[model samples]
Target: MLRMLFHPKSLKFLACIALAALTFSSSCKTVESSSGSLSEKSRTKTDVFFAEMYKKYNPYPIQDDPETPDDCQSLFKEADPSVPYKGVVVYFHGFTACPQQFYEFAQIMAKKGYSALAVLMPGQGRFPAPFNNDGKKTINGRKYKDYYSEYLPVKKGDDWKRYLNFVSDVNTFAATLPGEKLVTGLSVGGQLAAYAYVERPGLYKRALLISSYLGMPGSYSGRNSTTSGGMLNSLRRLSGDTIYHITKAVSQQGSNLDIIADREVSWGDKCYQQTRGFNGNPGRRGICDFHVENIAAINSLGEYILGQIKASPALTQIPQIQYVGPEWDTGGDTLLVRKAIGYQKARFGDDKVNACFFPNVVPHSMFARKDIAVLPETPWINSFMLETTKFLETGATYKVSQEPSEETQWDGASDQDSGVFQNRCDVYAVDYSKVSP
Candidate 1:
């Protein structure tokens, strides 16, 4: 049958050829389903996006040396039984970021009563095989020249699928940890965390998304609208066939789950002040600094996370929600998670589903005050780990989410984007005393 060669390992082009042959042999099949909510829509978008991406972007195996350092299992902490240990803190590295990048946070969480797990994803941990070229640095076996562009491998719509599979994988790993686990993603990992919250809710107690783009869903631009229209038409024309192929692929782990960067990014600030350059303001931070900022990403991440909590399957309201970023005490990441926990307690108290947003926190410091680039640190990170540990142990609650009109978000030195920041809420915390019945 023409469908014979159509498999994941079926190297894209060959599948096209196989589909071509099948055209002569059988009738077409199409897929159908019901959906609503951000998660479902995001998944739908991701699937369509990846399918299109695979057609354009080829996934070649890259070279990676799978080395497990002795420091792998170094992070661990005792879960407080007084309160349920929702989950451990698992750190995922960004592109080319090895376990080293997260050592500070990971070790701190472990000491703070969390069983921390830090692993690499894709080009992160180990290079994919297909070796050649003296083993220096290469992707798909070429000397690593244009890494961010070529190897990073992202497409416009893959956000959802990438998130879904990633959470599934993280959960599988969490199951093996000392206790339940929460996710703390950085940069690209943070983006994955946002999508994962939508794709897989309740998998973690709460998530900390740092320096990520948790933008809005749905296509708005004329180009995306038009492309989406064509896709709909194509799906209609080859409904039967498309269904068969997609269903089969989805059955096999959503093979089309690759994320590609949007040539023209749509939602979120195209570029923040820091993202552009240092500009010379005390409040003004840069992309490199924010990448290490927890709160900035959290505010954006919180918007989407609130969606995840609202859309939760079990509707298990968490005791707390936290996002730590810069613009806090001394421009450090003093935007504690405790505040968000308090907020969740106030609004949807006792449901246990808590979500909070902290601002960007600068870790120690890297360069001169102006040119200084921020990264995560261990000593300062210990606080978050301790708070999380305490939350798990004491089941403490907090209140942070106050009425938006009541608070002035841009009052101080904020580099907030319009509609995104300007209008914000007065702060409150969660009430830990109330737990779900």
Candidate 2:
């Protein structure tokens, strides 16, 4: 009787009811400024358009920190006003990252005669409020309970739907630009770019997905810690649930997943130039510490997209795709990314799908800043930008190569062996010999 009563469908319905109740209760207690809607405005009027964008997307004040860096905000780079732009290029930064992550690249694209917009992802670029039992307090002119935090300000399912909707909005805005549309994104942003392309076939002329988030490895060498993916996926398969039940089991009632809520954020400069104290960076821009629920949400999107690709016989309508996989990526499951791309290549052939794998020394946030990426001797970043420009123009990939590190090894069978042990080798061996950079 209990099993029948608590059937998966029943449980989901109950969860929805519970969530709705929580929402109603919280809305009564929480005070927040409305994220104003963008009125249909002329894109040519840059100031009006951007002001509306800021109001709509980044409305919440950074609690206790009034000033936010310009780089961290949604940014737009225009080509020479005199010259007609070839197209518009949209860039999405990694999860927890600000638009600053792609500012430089956006500028590059702009210089190459493409209007570039680096969009700030939802729930980013705002600082979280300090923990408090009562969900009401004013801090830095914003309601504390309304702010995003691990201690629970607000959460709705995996939050993938919100993200997808945001993507659609951004693309719709970009569609108004003067020319053909192109997009590039890193990490979770890369996954969103894929979603944008897949959701609206032929909407983009080309897509560049770099280190797309699919899954995380069991451990991270940088953090010297085991990740939740290993344990979470194990539970997911066992429970045959979409990760929600496992989150519910681990988290307290009303908080689906806050396993690392108490863990002190130790991002220290990886997130920004400084980390003085607990939420004390006066100019802090992006989220440094996020809930495990965030990870589960992103992974769910990845799984859904992968399933969509697998289910389709052929995605012929989608334009050319350029996939950039890091040889050594700790942020996401590179193996899964490669496997998914392999599926696409098999279905559409080599002409439609292209991939490039960077070396092991490079960090997952390689494109963010020079200080962040422990780069090779080669000017790989510059070469990469040039290659991207070439691709946008001609749908061609340039050859970039150097001998693999002596310590690199590829003797592996399992995904783990192939992922961590391959040591940055391009396992799929997408031929890069066709053109020299």
lDDT of each: 0.34, 0.54
RMSD of each: 18.3, 13.4
- Residue-by-residue lDDT tens digits, candidate 1, 203-248: 6666654433333110110111223342122222323343333322
What is the Å distance of residue 2 in model 2 from its true position? 59
TM-score of 2: 0.66
Residue-wise C-alpha lDDT for candidate 2, range 206-303, written one tens digit per residue = 99888787664322212211343322232232223433343433333324445532222223333433322234323324555545455555666677
Deviation from native of the Cα of residue 392 in model 2, angstroms:
3.0
Name the lDDT of candidate 2.
0.54
Best candidate per lDDT, number? Answer: 2
What is the C-alpha local distance difference test score of candidate 1? 0.34
124 Cα displacement, candidate 2 (Å): 0.2
Prediction 1 TM-score vs. true: 0.41
